[model samples]
Target: MADYSEASPPPKNRQIVLLLSFFVGLTIALFLSVDLMVGVLIGWIPPGVERQLGALIVPAFEQQAAPSSAQDTLNQLLDRLKPHLSAEQQQRDYKVLYVPDETVNALAIPGDRIILYRGLIEQAESENELMMVLGHELGHFAHRDHLRQLGRGLLMQITISSLFGDISGIQSIALSAAQTIGNSRFSQNQEYKADEMGVTLLQKIYGQVAGATDFFARLSEKKDLPIDFLTTHPNPGKRVQRLEKLIQQNGWTVGDRSPVAESLKMP
Candidate 1:
């Protein structure tokens, strides 16, 4: 038969190659599906719905939060910063509120709200430091991070409900996951962008970069810094170093500047 058996292909080897290729293609498709799901979770919500969601959530938050007693002084700082922002930034009515917490924290809520905690204000060594904190919150708003975060929380709730099918068993787990999502860290890129915006705000307000790194320098000394680094923010040491580099690059002086408004008291 002219060696017909030798002419046949290696069927076992061909099957193995086909099996490997199938798995590779399946892996790629799975990754693409995950990427699409993440996009929908974070950015797919409509602006109107996002605003309505914010409006609804604000009331619940207000019930739990104590208003700032230093509103008048904080308002003065807002006025000064307002006149310097671009018209686009001015278009949105940004409002600031003070929360009565002792933790050094601040939050940028949806619907043009910035929650400034008293502890953060007390931690400020200068008005510039406080201004930088305000600027960072504004940066979060300008980038729509607040809305994105809210959307993610909502999506998580939907996903958990859909996956579990039974409400009673999974309700607690779903709630816990949603809370974690709400408090989760923004990507490193977002943090750096906020830092850049804060620096730009300082330059616009004061003709230099003074006090840009002051608060971060102090923050770096805390024992909880390592824990904080793994969570929401970059390490304070890295932030200070980056700010210092920015100052040197712009040839800005790190000199003493104007203090907080007289009406405001530190601590």
Candidate 2:
């Protein structure tokens, strides 16, 4: 009989074959896992998972967004608005965040996160205008605007990852999509809803029914970037037009009185 050891394949060749098998297995596993996660999460169109993810990332760093001084101001405003907002709406998937950057923008993330750039505070005409803006952002949360953005992003990530099958490429795609969707403009329709709701909230809280258009008007007419990547607010003119219509149609004339905030005079 031939010696069994002599008949066996060379150790070097066996090692190489084993290495190939391991890599192939690992690749398959990773592909399957990523694909499966994307499919499962997005497949049935489950409600609020989008909100959950947004919430997770938005308020992650406790002390990240604003400095202590600015935060103190925001907290005071929030305290004033607290009692009037429905408890459910009050604890929206959003938190007031302050970013020290000079960009004049405030926006909502997937969760209860609303970032107020220092530039935004500087741009405020009055405390009421600030409320109007915050109220508008809250309207987005209430209307599931951020959740819709999250859905599109989740779909985009899954698609890009599945097509590429390269982990690093998929990660990069996800990052880009995440950033884009977070900053993407709300359509005219969504903007209208926010304007209406924000106006309603403002009217209710302050009993002063001023058009929130002034905020957008300032940006729209600016020689510098009234709208740029970091400061892309919805078109002020369109938003103003819509809000004005709602006020007339809904008879949303002011007469509310809250005991909290320092009231702004309404037109």
Candidate 3:
């Protein structure tokens, strides 16, 4: 306890601490800069490159999907929404791979494919509501949200691997990216933008925004189910409120909903 007030770290220890602090600070700065570049980088990615990356992941879903009338019907519905997409989006080949599973979820993967689970289709009470869900997925594609979900770390890895022509490394990263995409949750702002796009598309298809929020409203009531859709998506109640506000702001009219196609009805 002698002269404790004058105690100081040795010169060597101080240098070590300074080096560690510098590295930590540099790492954080690099992370933030990479994140900031993600939006801009994604815009520069061509559809061809996106499809190549998607090819690595699409096979897994393709194996799960069973080609049937249900899959056909889902694709047909997706086609209907195509006309309303932007000219650039319309040029890309989009399809739906319908999986006959009880998981209530839909996904827009990199390869311009929408994965629609049977459970989600069963939950839809009307054609328009189902279309709204489809439109929402399409919104993801329009905004390049699927790639954005890959996170900054994986994105930077992919970019670097591709730049170095490391095909094997890219494939490995793609596999991990697939798993991440399956469980990823979009940002609340991303969800809202998708909802806005969905409602706009619904209006174009039906001349009214009927059933736009019906699916979400119903799901919002069932809070106990261990549903993947609920797990990965933003709160349904919040989404419904936002959609209603958007519809009101835009003077969108609500009308009767169309019946779900027989092909999509649960047996």
Candidate 4:
């Protein structure tokens, strides 16, 4: 009688399967560790090194930015918010580069620069709202969210390239770093923390948190609008809820909102 016995799998096939599983597990572990490592390593990175990384990325935005009254208005707002920052953050010369593009977005890049697009300005109905937005970006700087967005891998590459004085490697890494930042998204917790910081600064500067959630509340109402800010940021509705809660929890009062300056208003 023919014996019906299950045959063992081929050794080669089993080896390949195990090897693939090993690599997959290793990849998952690395990814999970990167964020934790980045959090620890970021605090150690000096502002000077950050500027070097920014040197590679800021030029692209700088070339796109034009000097205008709008830009001047933005920097003035940033200057007003500067004193509210910690002494360490105040040491860096923070400025705004207002881009004429109507992309409806703002960015806190490596170079202590806030890239504010005209589209975002057009969305603002009040000076307080704009100041809150500016304050929000400063919060990113204070928390080093910009660097955190770059990931530990690219950060390591940049640091190593800089240390070794590898000009060519550094140049290549710069492009990667810029692309990573452009496409990256901040975590919801990070956004909430930044919002809290913005609210605190708004209260300190204007003595009330008026317009703290106005910009976000407005954006949340216009769901049909194709705003780029919504893409990289958390849902506007959620942010509005969180900010409102923060204000109430702290017993902060909401006062009148200052009107946006004519020069800064989008046509």
Candidate 5:
């Protein structure tokens, strides 16, 4: 009883300690929130690191079967389109890779890489439709949307890895989840921007925006939208409407359709 005063702290000191603890907790919470937002909304990974990560990540997800003949055809198409790209676009070293899959999907990744599945090529009703798809993917690359997507994915993995000390067994799971989230999360505004750029590129290369919306219009006619990582594009009907509006505004006329390349036959 005689030593109680010496053992007990003053009320002011207790209040100060409480205030400090509150601030420290608040700071930690704020940091975590910022980290989440950066991973989800502000993909800002540096280019070199993004390429390195892409080199490691993309191949793992691609089908191993080779598409030598289809690839040659794709390259020929790419070469034909190259003359129309601006110096800025051409200088970026854009590449289109063919994946031997029948998923009817295309993916634009970091390092200016675009992967087109054989199914998508076969699904196109005309050469103009296929070019529209290529142009749309190129638009994504030009805007660095591919980098942004890859960055966001890596950020999520890094965060999870840091918390768990490693992501050995979980890397595939994390990647799969990231791909799902990233594919579906591209905003409507971003979709519009890519569409606008695609139409512009089509007009530049082919002299008209004909069949720019052909793919979307076909999808819109489906009984149900294809549910897959490849279907990240905006609502099919809405995308067609937007493209039609843009074409009308620019006084662009639809051009004659060209048959799909014979060599582009699906495997």
Candidate 6:
């Protein structure tokens, strides 16, 4: 038998080539996936603003006068919702803030702060609809999305820090290349978790849940609402599908249909 124990190792050149190819392929695939998903999430965004995340936070979407009456309605909804929602479950420490913009959007910040845009408030067809939508935002927060964003360090720094020190420009170039894929690199399991939790929140307040479903149905029918690759909410049609299914399966009755929880609205 051959003296296998004494056999020499693979040649250095071959090892180097193998290693280089493996790393190169891995890096390409990893970043490609990341860029793709972020791109899709922000798809409805303007092309220029969509390109760089830093650009999206800017001078401000037009500021508006939030009517006192609307604020009262919102408060009524949150009061009921607070007991039902898991404050600690979503890794969020949330306090609601009103945004000045008219476009229906809500965002959760790192410190448990959620900004409810005026646009989102006014557009909601009913109090239930707004609660359902708010539930999703809360789901994102409890899931610790803010923490994950921080973990990414700098979307710009990943290249320079991961590669050679001189590779600063490579960050932008790399991000641009990755944007084409538009597939969120995070495991699909997370999305499922959000969906399930959101449903639970909706179940507790199905009237609000029904409102959310109705709102999505309305949004799906609209020609003007920007449905883009980068937006995270998915399509209103898909949302309606999921929301309706939840209702049908549980035969859940509507909860307080009065309006946005009174305690949640700003004074």
Number of the top lDDT candidate: 3
**Please, what is the whole-model Cα lDDT of each candidate in the order they appear?**
0.67, 0.63, 0.88, 0.85, 0.69, 0.52
Q: Give a tens-digit lDDT track for model 3, residues 37-146.
A: 99867865666667778999899899999899999988888899999999999998999999999988899998888999998888889999989988998999999999
| Candidate 6 CA-lDDT value | 0.52
TM-score of each: 0.72, 0.63, 0.86, 0.85, 0.70, 0.54
| Tens digits of per-residue lDDT for model 1, 132-236 | 887887788777666455444455654454454535433443344335433667766677778888888888888887778888888788766534334667778
**Model 2 per-residue lDDT tens digits across residues 163-211:** 5454554444445445665467766777788777778878777666763
Model 6 lDDT tens row, 135-170 = 765776566453234223243343333344434453
Q: Lowest summed lDDT over 10 consecutive residues: which window, candidate 1?
A: 169-178
- lDDT winner between candidates 2 and 3: 3
Candidate 1 Cα deviation (angstroms), residue 160: 16
lDDT of 4 by residue, 90-209 (tens): 899899999998788888999888999888889888999999888888989889999888887877776676567666776777788877876688989988998999999999998999
List of clashing residue pairs for candidate 2: 54-110, 54-111, 55-111, 65-98, 93-111, 93-112, 94-112, 94-113, 95-112, 95-113
1 versus 4: better TM-score goes to: 4
TM-score order of candidates, top first: 3, 4, 1, 5, 2, 6
The pairs that clash in candidate 4 are none
Please provide, for model 5 over 198-220, each residue's C-alpha lDDT reduced to its tens digit, 9 standing for 90 to 100: 78878887788787988888888
Give the lDDT of residue 157 in candidate 4: 75
Worst 10 residues of 6 by lDDT: 53-62
For all predictions, the C-alpha RMSD in Å is 7.0, 15.2, 4.8, 4.8, 9.0, 11.5
Colliding residue pairs in candidate 3: none
Better of 3 and 5 by TM-score: 3
Q: Give me the runs in candidate 1 sitting further than 4 Å from their true place.
A: 1-46, 151-182, 224-230
Q: What is the lDDT of residue 68 in candidate 2?
A: 60
Ranking by lDDT: 3, 4, 5, 1, 2, 6
Query: Residue 92: error of model 6 in Å?
Result: 6.2
Query: Whose lDDT is higher: candidate 2's or candidate 5's?
Result: 5
